[model samples]
Target: FQISLPSLKERVQDIPVLAKHFVAVFADKTNKAALEITDDYLAALKQYTWPGNIRELKNIIERSVILEEAGKLTTDTLPFEITHTQETGNLSSFDLALVEKQHIKKVLNYTKGNKTETARLLNIGLTTLYRKLEE
Candidate 1:
């Protein structure tokens, strides 16, 4: 007798658990700081269409874990498509420049208009920051 399991899209709530599990499994192997997935990250996962199902989600989580800094996982650690899932409706609907602009402004607000701090927080160069803001 075989039991059927749900796809990642069919089990949205499981994202956080699986992501955490993967983080623990990989962080130790890579000797990196343990990653903490933010609420926004989990929400984004739920909103995404899992065409590749759990494998895709797992790969994304692994990438975030590898790229994690100071132990916190921000939406910035994720791909623009995943981070902008809410705005674009689907991957094919992405507007990267618009997304970058909004993210830059949001970060700028967070850093109280400090371009240097905003650039550092966004993991971008100062020139890149200036260029994006100009767009």
Candidate 2:
């Protein structure tokens, strides 16, 4: 009988078990018995949205195991976007636009709102920057 498992995002709660299984399989294949996952690491995995699901998780684990010097996995070992998502949740397009506006405002502030300098720093034309601010 062929039983197809659901995607990882559809079964995010299974990450820990899957991670453990992968670790065991990898450890056996590499003849490295000292490797083990930490609770913190698993928690981070659970918190992630896993847009790419199990395949992405598997690739990340494999990459981490291959590159990690120690047997332990830390949140730092995960990709930056994962951490960003965990901290900020998923940002909407409006949120992104706000961030960009804030950044432009900061740069302008630093230049004392000098359009020419702000545009130069931002690598945009003064007229374009003005138009953007108006929008």
lDDT of 1: 0.82
Best by lDDT: 1
Minimum summed lDDT over a 10-residue window in model 1 is located at 68-77
Model 2 pairs in collision: none
For each candidate in turn, the TM-score is 0.72, 0.57
What is the RMSD of candidate 2?
A: 9.7
Question: In candidate 1, what are the lDDT values of residues 16-135, reduced to their tens digit?
Answer: 888889888878887987677788878888888788998898798888887776687777677777877677777777677887797788678667799999999999999999988887
Tens digits of lDDT, candidate 2, 1-135: 899978777786789989887777766666666576877778778878787887788877776566555677665456555545655667442366555666687678667779899999999988889887987
By TM-score, the best candidate is 1
Query: Model 1: number of clashes?
Result: 0
Candidate 1 deviant stretches above 4 angstroms: 99-135
